[model samples]
Target: MNVSINIKWPLIILLMLPFTLAIGCLIQIKHFAPEPLILKKDEIFTLPSGTNYAGLEKLLRRQHLAKKTCWLPWLIKLEPKLAEVKAGTYRLQPGMTVRDLLNLLVSGKEAQFSIQFIEGERLKEWLTVLSRAPYMKHDLHDVTPQTLGVKLGDPADSILEGEFYPDTYLYTATTSDSAILKRARQRMKLMLLKIWEGRAEGLPYETPQELLIMASIVEKETAIKEERARVASVFINRLRAGMKLQTDPTVIYGISEDYHNSITRRDLMTPTPYNTYIINGLPPTPIAMPGQASLKAAAHPEESEYLYFVADGRGGHVFSTNLASHNQAVRKYRQGHDIRGNNE
Candidate 1:
């Protein structure tokens, strides 16, 4: 009986603990917790494109991000105006909660944007693309290779045309042309070095830079993707045989004062440093930003004595050892396709 009178404060405390925690959870759930996690795109994303909320949720469900979005629908219902959340480009962090992400969606917030540049694009084309970079307010069209912080020798020198590497580059829209151009040059150097490391031996090229020149030719020759290696081989064959590559693209490149797309035979015959038809060896530089595939093709050309090639016009090419076979292939493949051969 005396023992029964003893105080059970520990048990009483234990019983009240659940209630206290429950109340604390309720208070947190109601109004005491953080509003939302601040997602800084400038700091988080390295690439230009990525996921939205639902997409993020789906991805998170697969463990890309942390969980806690199970009650997302209910949480969104907590703030009906939040349900009107506008999807926007953001730099979301890892472990963002449903409620936190909801607030970010409801609030328009951006510090930067992701931008991409594909291979085979012209440098002039990049001006338009950079002009539209998010958070960037200034016009980059006027900025050239010299003004962009990247030192390419002379002031009027614009050797960066086809030198910009192909890849996903990270930059805030507020990033300067100088920074961008420097980054681009670095990327190009990195890419060239990588291609050089894997270059095939016994090729006619003296250096990787020369290989880039050949790659540009391969890129411009046939749009047929599978023909790159062979096309590169044909150019290499010409270089090795002391024969002029006679590539029209190089001629077109020469007279392209304003970056014209096509050229006439007269343009090919016209004397210029870039016209392979009128000169010998590779062009002074690359005509376009050759992709990795094109670079690889240039590094490792398909072995052949055939110094001639003509477009099949069906996303392919016909290789030939001489003009007769090349002409036959042209008639069968090219039909009315011009640029077969000058001697023919």
Candidate 2:
């Protein structure tokens, strides 16, 4: 044993070179390959708050993403600048690589969800939509609208109906219904203030709240975008002339809880705080949430002498400047006249 043969260190190093290079290449391939957490579009993956590299490796191994546990170490050592991965629910595409997944995780961009509040929807409808929205934490189901309004910093006498802006709201998985409502409420206040500042001169509205009430009525009256300004003008003219609004939407809203199918003559004659046919001024509160377009129309109505309008037997309306023309238009509508061709 003492008389050992001389062995060259270079030869030993050369013999080991190929194996080391092979391992290095395999690690590189695995690092650049598709991610271990890649899932289908409908599938979700969650990483707990304190998940570390070791935990991630085990999870990948369980998912059969790698043949061995050596690649993660190499990847991590190579990219030391990558921050610690955040903890949250994530969705990964099929083609995402390990590098891409790591980048997404470290950037702390969690999954985003959307909830929509449609224009002209009632507060009841909004609550239903919120309760049914996916991933929304519904804690306000038992809360009354008045209570919610107070929590939103509205006046003690304020009604919650139509106070929130209608639009698509973005939130995280844990966002509460109250949080979304708060944001929408603030947005609505801002929008109302801006529109109020740009309102047309000599308008009949004495306050922003009155303008909102009018806007809500306009929203419910017509689905046609071109008719909004004209509809607003008709209401404004009626207000200026001290005439009853006589709008069907307000009557329907007054009895919405018991409304079944059609409006009866008796219903129009019935008096309520919201019955424009019987009330001298705007309703006590808004009937439904109005979109920005309706709000704008209410703020700056088309200047016209039109005091009355009737459905033109189409998806629009016919405007008239006097009761006689309005009565004639009503007769035409009753007689199934095709007034669409005559309306501009």
lDDT of 1 by residue, 155-189 (tens): 55547666777677776544665467557878777
Q: List the residue pairs that clash in candidate 2.
A: none
CA lDDT scores, all candidates in order: 0.68, 0.82
User: How far is 328's C-alpha from truth in model 2 (Å)?
Assistant: 2.7
Query: What TM-score against the true fold does each predicted structure earn?
Result: 0.64, 0.83
lDDT comparing candidate 2 with the true structure: 0.82
For candidate 2, the C-alpha RMSD (Å) to the true structure equals 4.7
Model 2, C-alpha of 239: deviation from truth (Å): 1.1
